[model samples]
Target: MKRLCKKRELISMDLTPLIDVVFLLLIFFIVASEFKKNETILNLSLPNSASKENIVEKKAIVIELSEKKLAYKTSEIDFVQLEQKLSLLQKDSQLTVKIDKEVKYKRVVKLLDILNKLQLSNLLLITKSQ
Candidate 1:
């Protein structure tokens, strides 16, 4: 008498569901991510310049000068406070001055003077292309 042999089924994993889950997660993150814009909340009429080069630096210190008040980022700050803040920043940190066209010339000069005194080398002036 011969003994009958039993056939064993091969085990396999279906990866279609895994792939679908991964793709769904990717889509969710893409939709949830925020995109930064060049537009600022502060109303500013930027000066026009012939230069077209746009340089963006990491951890840039932005100082906005409007006709009425000076702002460090979004909060309004005084000149002395600005100086104190600048003094705390690293020497290599990039500084971007965004001055409104209607702002007084003396205000710009004062800010420049402070920057000059600090000896911050990475300085930039934000202007619109004409």
Candidate 2:
């Protein structure tokens, strides 16, 4: 009697389902994610200063002043409208002002006067750090 040997086959995994699930998750996140808008639209050069200390505040109202216009959260507004909007904010709410380097000093003084009237003492001036 002669003895016979049996041949063995290699096992492999099917990764098609795994790849499909990964692609579906990527698509879902891409559709549900929110992109941040560019906050600075005005072509104004910011002044630089050598300051190491920085303060970060949450939920502060941002006001941007350019040579041509004033902006609040990307919307161009006038002084009257800005005053009305600021009037609605809480007396202690923090305010951040981003004024262009070339903007006149009087405009800044005017804004400061408005803030003084509203008594918004928590103010932050945004400037570039050198």
In the range 33-79, model 2's lDDT, one tens digit per residue, is: 98887776666688998877567585778889887799886788999
Model 1 root mean square deviation, Cα atoms:
6.7
lDDT of 1 at 25: 100
> Could you give me the TM-score of model 1 versus the true structure?
0.70
Query: What stretches of model 1 exceed 4 Å from their correct place?
Result: 1-27, 30-32, 37-39
The candidate that wins on TM-score is 2
lDDT of each: 0.85, 0.86
Clashing pairs in 1: none
Please tell me which predicted candidate would have the highest lDDT against the true structure.
Answer: 2
List candidate 2 segments past 4 Å from native.
Answer: 1-15, 31-34
Clash pairs (backbone) in predicted model 2: none
